[model samples]
Target chain A: MMAKEISKSNYLQIDPWENLRSLSKARIALGNSGGSLPTREVLSFQEDHAFTKDAIYSDLKEKELLKHLQDFKLPVYQFQTKVSDRKEYLKRPDLGKKLAETSESENGDFDILFILTDGLAADAINERAIPLLKEILPKLNDYKIGLCLVKFGRVAIGDEIAEKLNAKFTAVFIGERPGLSSPKSMGIYTTYEPRSETTDERRNCISNIHENGMSIEKAADLLQYFIKESFRRKISGVKLKASLPNQIDRK
Target chain B: MAYKFTLRGKTYSFKDLKTVLAKATPERSGDALAGIAAEDNKERIAAQYCLSEIPLKAFLDDLLIPYEKDEVTRLIIDDHDTEAFKPISSLTVAEFRDYLLSYEVDGKTLKGLAPGLIPEMVAAVSKIMRNQDLISIASKIEVVTKFRNTIGLKGHFSVRLQPNNPSDDPKGIAASIIDGLMYGCGDAVIGINPATDNPQEVSKLLKQLDDFRQQYEIPTQNCILSHLTTTFEIIDKAPVDLIFQSIGGTEKTNSSFGIDLKLLQEAYEAGKELGRGTIGNQMMYFETGQGSSLSADAHHGVDQQTLEARAYAVARKFDPFLVNTVVGFIGPEYLYDGKQIIRAALEDHFCGKLLGLPMGCDVCYTNHAEADQDDMDSLLTLLGVAGCNYIMGVPGADDIMLNYQSTSFHDAMYLRKVLNKRPAPEFEEWLLKMGIFDDQGNRKELKEQMLKLK
Candidate 1:
């Protein structure tokens, strides 16, 4: 039998969906050159991935972040998890959830505590954390608030910090895992009466906060709503339903 | 029972069959994380040697998780084909490996022996064999299934056109579907992983997929990968061709996913009642991966690869049209790098095919994992050679919603061109009629007719 000859084309065949690229960030309408991605598109994808990788390895600007936290006129404290460095933090997630033996802790009675950590993407916390806090700090001014910055921390670290500080609620502002399109996205996890043993089900999360995704103002509003409802119902997470009056219940 | 072997003047003893299986597994990060891996290479080889001498009947005698405690174990024991086991029942694990690689064991013999072999037995043999051995044995075994078109025929390759959107936007999904169709993909299914599990949103996406499929007259099936209960709640009102679920090996892991054998059976019945197939009626699609049970804290001390094999037993019970292992989607903590991902994908395909299930692979990796496009290309090429049933066909190999990179439409075309494979026969014919491909099966330039799909 004779082998079939593979086709070769000199120019790329552009997809008509190129007009629809604005509708979604998905990599659609990629013009092809004989069943393969064009040279420019391939390189463009690689460049975006490079940015994401860099973000994952980037360090949090703790000094700058701490200065920004002081603008709220609340007490600011810094802590570190048990993880020694980034490599260990990525390999052993269990270590990142525990407090370091030497790290200082604060004993304060507060209604809400905000803890910031540079999760998979430090650029997220560095770029958007302050702007979001500015939008949210005033709405929560009627109650006592404390700000804490952690290095090499995971989501569960907030549980331990809240338990130590004796706060009624904990709102964690951590960087999300960087996606190709949205490298500077942060996630907020709010839990009521948080303890070190708290599982993921006990916390309510609002993710994908960035310039390209959810705006800081919208996230602040959602966080405020969750805090008020949690205090009223004495619950959070799976049980605390986000039942806004304007939205219809799909169920 | 205790198993021991003396290798290079050092004696190693495993506490039980589960311990031996875990020790003998290839080096992976999940086993190391679970603290079940051998301390060194010599200990691993000793465990492999000890495992090779154990007879095939030993697995049947000693249950890994115990029949009474785990429904998966009970299913395996109750569904044993004793008569079919007669041919290789007397062979030890080493002998079984040799028997499979022998010249006489062709596709027909393998199919006849499939029901007789358990997941543990196949996983054991796979542990001792090389990557090429897995490929060679799997290429001979053809486990075909059908919904609207046939899959897993000899000299045929298929692609699951995964048009996932971040927010389930209908127009964005439609554009991706048309793009995939223009490249002659989506023969296996046009499946989507919805961002939310709301039944209303799932029903809307299902309706959009069904309408687009009907409008284009594409020879394929459509599925929305959601929780089993969500599908059941909307099965009566939606246009679902295949019921999709992410199944695991143990009862507890399935519980975490909120599913059980009874729920799976119920969903199967619902899909069967719809009668939504033109050629055949195999209407279940399952996605499994290594370390799912471990992630759920329910592995029961078994290795990830062995548990992955047991998941195939669940898929086989329902006779699924398509079953794939999202091999690398479970992060680096499970499969550290490219080498580990490739090994796990080959092992999954080999084990699934040997157990009489139609196995495919997602050929994907997460951004956090230490892998790149080169790794995906290598796995895709190897799976194509191993007679994989289907691979994911995302545009440009980037999944924006899930934030992972998988095989691309161009990767599928490259595999077919290099391996001399064609799409499912019916779908290939549809492509010809639609002017997507010329008579020689070479892709044609984009035509005006193709762009007028809307």
Candidate 2:
């Protein structure tokens, strides 16, 4: 599997950003213990357009998804009116992420908000994003949940909305650009602080979190662990790892 | 039989998935970066990546040496020939998030946000801009066709033209564009180079243009526009902003002008000066009339590398980039010879990199075989590759279109539509959906229409 197509020199370049000296590489020995996993109330690709919202929501209700999201231990009161004409939505993205009318008039002080937006491929979000959200929602209670608004359309919407709502760690679950390899892929753009000016790299993303790749349950646990390590190391992306357990107890 | 793969300077062989895991499992690197790689590991990197390049090695050495814990640095390259990978993304989510949370709001910190937040927003903005720009251009192209098909334009080929009046006539036309709205029709972008050689002429031309715009109430949709060449005007004096304060005719309507880049960069570095986003620039291009030809000399023709210099300098200084290059030329000749120009621009490391609109040489070929006005312009417009202001001539030989100028006005108008916007397939559909002609930019009704490709 490793050597079919790629040549010798090229393959050598693989994972060079990681380490090289360790002669002893680890194999996932038959026993790998479970950390924190999720019981996913999975929704197939066809099930949830009913729950999905768009950049144009006729009337946004704030309290709708909160309770189920509340069980996740994170805040869900925030909702942005991610609605605007396609042109302004593209050019002036800042306006696309204003808080849902009700939330904009009112206020909430939650740090590090999480937004679940259906970017370029709303279909992918409808299929998988909601499931991943359901899985991660309950686990978020351990940390203080900032208010969030799930939007639809392009990813940059999160940048402006993040600034509008001052969040320490703002994460947006937007659809990834559908590669030929996978169209139903999802990614999490987690930034240190939410602002209109945040960029791609500054935000950590966990990609392939849909049916086409990683399982939703694994994605949820992985993200939960990612958050802890991110806060602990204060960094993420290629350099993230769960803290080593003192005891390797197999479940 | 063994299949071998090399990674991070080490070669490993895998007979299959079994041997693949046996050979190259996720080996821990204690050190994520070379700088932290306790001595011996760093030596190996020098041997593999360093190819007779010392400065490259030395540069990497210095970058690696600074890898103390806490600082996140990713890419380093010593090969000047190779693309230089930035170690830090211009902005990272971590830093941006902290900055946002840290922003001050009502005596309380609004997630610690600050002006530094501008960079990431800028990058993200640039990413999605392609879609919007493409839509705008397409709509313009399609819309012009709905009007006159045989269009052309004739304005100053060099100097700007301003009218002779001042106080009473704000929208009057300079002698250069006296034909004004009635001058061009159909699809084209004939630059109104009003031959205002002096400040007074420029002022007069400017006044005339304003007056003409007001008199005709020339909807930006009408095509012919004033491309004010103000660089030759008095730079040491004059209130520039007064002219630029004309974003009113249409919310997106821009009063265009051309400025020397070096001068613009100098002003930007001087301070947070305005006029950075407006008044386009003439970018460098390799244009030497061939068939009706001239030799390739520095002053004569420029490659992409030479052209992108001032703009990059300006962008580095955080100034907005607004310019177009003259990469193409027309005349008695059939095809444009821009081979040398295109090759160098693409190869040059710094120039024309990540630029939004960089046209290849010979942008519009086909010799205008298509007799239809739209066909001639679209074929020629490709040369722009979305860069440089596409200059079009009146298609079909109609001097009345140019309104007495040597070129045709009908062609210019059609080409102007292409230049000023991204031409759409169904312009009427887009306009009606966007409610473009209405007082309110009622794009709300057309939401589904735009997203659906026809």
Q: What C-alpha lDDT values do all the predictions have?
A: 0.86, 0.31
Task: Please compute DockQ, using alpha carbons, for every candidate against the native two-chain complex.
Answer: 0.30, 0.01
TM-score for all predictions?
Answer: 0.89, 0.29
**Model 2 stretches with alpha carbons more than 4 Å out:** A1-74, A91-94, A97-111, A137-141, A153-166, A179-181, A235-251, B1-454
Error of 2 at B252 (Å): 26
lDDT for residue A172 in candidate 1, whole number 0-100: 95
Residue pairs in collision within model 1? none
In every candidate, how many clashes are there? 0, 85
Error in Å for residue A78 of model 2? 4.6
Docking quality (DockQ) of candidate 2: 0.01
Positional deviation of A81 in candidate 1, in angstroms?
A: 2.6
Could you give candidate 2's per-residue lDDT for residues B1-454 as a string of tens digits?
A: 2334444666543332212211121111111111121134433333222211112122233332123411111111111222222321243322322232232311122112211212212222221222223222222220011111111111111111111211111222222132222222211221332211224444544454445444533322211121222322333343222121001010011111122334334444332332311223221111211111111011112111221231232232222211222222221111212332222222211122222222212222111111122323443444233233223332121111111112123333333344443222232233344332122211122223332211
